[model samples]
Target: MIRNTRSGWGSISRWFHWILAAAIIGMIGFGWWVNHVPARPDRFFYRSIHADIGYLVLLLMVLRLVWRAANPTPALPADSARWTRVAAGISHAALYLITILVAVLGWAHSGAHAPDYSSFFGWFHVPQFTTPDREAARAYEDRHILFAYVLLALIAVHVIAAAWHHYIRRDRVASRMVASDAGTSR
Candidate 1:
């Protein structure tokens, strides 16, 4: 049987996916919440936590990519209209691009001058990955923020598509991506 994604997307992929979602959502909320706080020395604390989590997301994304390369998924539902398939492909591709873009910007922004903290989310120390400089940090920060907005919009579309498939299409379009028995009994 042809598999678009390895049966159930492989253990690593599932783990990476859930973990990445947690990290991204957590960082987004924390980052937004902290914006109202004063810029005291301790203000860096929240950011430190956000940075660490963001780094882990990057590493996991890389591993996920490697796994994707190793196991190519099957096409979307064959019964899906051609336009649906195209839209799905475009949305997924955009998700991937945004993932990379956000991770890189986040790393570069923090790497310039890491505060007195370590670990990509308190896990382990990540040595300053880039030279210390203000210009570099600013540029990286701008890109990171811009990409985050883009990512949020894309995620909105992704959720809508999944909802459409599950509630309206009444097909396995969404399940196939998340379930091992997706196309079974075909």
Candidate 2:
């Protein structure tokens, strides 16, 4: 009833978004940085870190979905064209689903052997989902990379859409999702 227009994003979405952003960005950076190191141990360390970030991203994605389901999103911009809204809806869904699948596939690639069901710390163990096979690892690992490319494409589309709405359209489409509810423009 008392929605403030310019306050802040909803707590659940805000936390979900920022944390997932940090993890994915960090994973991307670490992935780029990994090749520079030659030592096997160092490589493993980088891999482990990247994988950890992936796990965090996947976990957050699940939580975000649940939150979205329970709370529902604010309405789309009143003036947004039907096709534009549909494209945005589809692209956003693809981003969430593909990103989670990519991470899960990668984790399965690495952890199928149980690998001690490891985490970065002794913090906790994520159960190994299946048994190991070198061939299976290679296949799923390649698929995971392909999934990454697809995710990147989807992200590009999302970014372009956000920019189009914010700049060209002078709309609050992206702002409502990213902003704390400064006011209930939605």
Candidate 3:
């Protein structure tokens, strides 16, 4: 279904969740790989791809936020514990906040470090908003790394919680956000 039911997520929501999850995870690995590459001409090409993907991620994040705001999420299972619901709410909020921050920091980091200009797939250019500064770039990069770790930890918790609900609680909490078999026909 296109709209969420009381028991599960809509297809749009499921697509957004999984797509963003994959993009973010891939960007994390790409970011690390680019940093480790030897100083070669091809490294710049890889960095350009990273920057393009970062911009795409930012766009997706914005779209996801709008989608989330416009749509209703499935309600927690009726039998869920109060603490479980509360934790879910907080963790979800944190995930949103951190995702936004990570994207912004990446953009800012690029602006702060770019020697000449930032290009998006060579079709367009993203202006560097901040003046290039070695120190500031270092600081932004450090925070980006730190928050990335935090995001990773939150993802682990999210996955574990979903597994707990699915396997231990035998509830729809996990499936609702997954493929959405109408919120859990199981």
Candidate 4:
């Protein structure tokens, strides 16, 4: 199905979910590597790539939010506990909010650095919202790192919850995202 039904996610939603999940996870690891690399000419190359990806992530996330708002989300299992449903809602919100915050923080950090690296793949210059200051850059970088860790923790919890639904509850909650919804009725 191209559009989601009450019973399960559609192809578009699943694609967005999986693609964002992979991109966000990969970005986290790549960002870590970029931070750890020694100062070298090629380090700027890696930083530029990371900045470009961060821009793309920010754009994709906005589109995903729009898509989500316009679409029908699959309902949770009827037997799910009230707390489980509440937790699911809160976690999903945090995921979206934190993802956006991290991207913005990275952008701000890049802009504030003495040697700005906020260009979009060298295609065009991204406007720096703040004056280039080493101290400000460091502060933004620190918050970026802290929130990134929070995002990572949230992802771990999300994965565990999905596993619990799939294994312990033996419900179709997890499969609703991974499997085709063609056979599912509204």
Clashes of each: 7, 18, 0, 0
lDDT of 3: 0.82
- TM-score, per-candidate, Cα-based: 0.82, 0.85, 0.92, 0.94
RMSD of 2: 3.2
Model 4 stretches astray by more than 4 angstroms: 182-186
At residue 151, give the lDDT of candidate 4: 96
Local accuracy by lDDT, each model: 0.72, 0.71, 0.82, 0.88
Quote the lDDT for 1 in model 3.
85
Ranking by lDDT: 4, 3, 1, 2
Give one digit per residue, the lDDT tens place, for model 2 in 24-118.
Answer: 76665676577457767566766776777777788889988887776646666677789987887888788888988888888888775335225
The residue ranges of model 1 lying beyond 4 angstroms of the native Cα positions read 1-8, 114-129
In model 4, state the lDDT of residue 182.
Answer: 35
lDDT of 1 by residue, 98-180 (tens): 98889777877887653433455555777666777878787888788888878888988988997998788777666655655
- lDDT value for model 1: 0.72
Error of 2 at 34 (Å): 2.6
Which structure is stronger by lDDT: 1 or 4? 4
lDDT of 1 at 153: 88
Which should have the higher TM-score, number 3 or number 4? 4
